[model samples]
Target: MIDKKQWQAEQAQFNDTSRYNDIMDKPRHVSHAHLPMTGRDRAGQFAPFAALTGYHELLNKIAQRYVNKKYPTGAEEQAIFDFFHQLPTGDAVRLELTYFNGESGYYEHYRGTLDHVNWAQQVAYFADGPQIPLRNIRVVNRKGNAHGQG
Candidate 1:
């Protein structure tokens, strides 16, 4: 490698700007064929690109491996069935629900009014718009009552 003094002496010639005198004060060149992009548009050009598409969703599926779908025990299942049997059809009652989500292998909880049960379809409709299948339900209780009391 060249000594520091020698490198500095060699680079000193580039510090002289007398050769660029003709264009030193000229305005910057602008393209006529393309309009200037906005700051956001320019930034997006350098943004990280996902070469492996759907990698994030794959990672999410892998992360969900630790979450097992919760199933109701025989007693809990009986309690859920009893709750439905005791509540008169078409009579709305406030309830909290814990049910399995097979798609994500996790138990989801909801608190809403039990709109009615559709025995023919074996689905329990909630006032808030979820129609959960009876088999997937793990826990169901009247809102004010303690668990398994329903």
Candidate 2:
């Protein structure tokens, strides 16, 4: 059974209006940038869920796919996995997320940097699927979109 407290914490972090309008679009909740890292020690620490879950393996897949690219650390990977492992999985997904400005926090501004910015300004994060909790880094239609600029 899913741990009540652990699931609650994950749910709290992932609590956002999640609606996928299309399979070809990003999650209205989580972007595709911050992919979770599967813990190397699947036999311990997170063994409770890892015992009967595929998310651990999925984390490894996500790491192998974009581990070196995002400059992620061991803890960051674990955090990502602990967050998204709640969602259903099938096909592997390539995720991305918010852009940063210096080191204030997360990129939450929608100022339209280039006016006609043609590229998909949405932050991308790779995951096992699109049902993951996607907050902190959001866009206009995105859930975690912040306001104002520094």
Candidate 3:
């Protein structure tokens, strides 16, 4: 069973008044290498591991809403990726991610931390896999505009 109340709370927090929307929905882009450069000048630039907050909660939500109903496969990833891809490069949603990445089931509740937000640059493309790993999560600085400052 899922923590219905807690999930609702977290969703509320994620959608709270935050510029997360601006960041998640950007139209510009930049690409980083997914491979490594162990011994060269590019030595620490190509790490592939990604860190996503609320890892489990996010996964579970997506699974239930998008994956659990059917076979979780490469195509599933493509679907998720495509969904994100179509999101006008300028409308990212900042959802609250849980701490411990969902290590404790009860920890699934939102802790009210803005630790990070994904700009949703571009959804990762996985040709074949069990599930699509949330990849290319660019940290958004949310540059301010003319009228008001960030």
* Candidate No. with top lDDT: 1
Better of 2 and 3 by lDDT: 2
List RMSD in Å for every model shown: 15.9, 26.2, 28.4
Candidate 2's C-alpha lDDT?
Answer: 0.39
User: Which stretches of candidate 1 lie above 4 Å from their native place?
Assistant: 1-67, 147-150
Q: Please say which candidate is ahead in lDDT: 1 or 2.
A: 1
The regions of model 2 sitting more than 4 angstroms off are 1-68, 88-142, 145-150
Question: In model 1, what are the clashing residue pairs, if there are any?
Answer: none
Each prediction's total of clashing residue pairs, residues at least 3 apart in sequence or on different chains, is: 0, 20, 7
Question: How many residue pairs in model 2 have overlapping backbones?
Answer: 20
The sequence of per-residue lDDT tens digits that candidate 1 reaches over residues 1-150 is 357998898788778889999999999999999999999998788666645667777877776753685556788767777778888666668888787766667778888888888889988888889898887887677755544422
> What would you estimate as the lDDT of candidate 3?
0.37
Q: Relative to the true structure, how large is the alpha-carbon lDDT of every model?
A: 0.76, 0.39, 0.37
Best by TM-score: 1
Models 1 onward score TM values of 0.48, 0.18, 0.21
The alpha-carbon lDDT assigned to residue 45 of candidate 2 equals 72
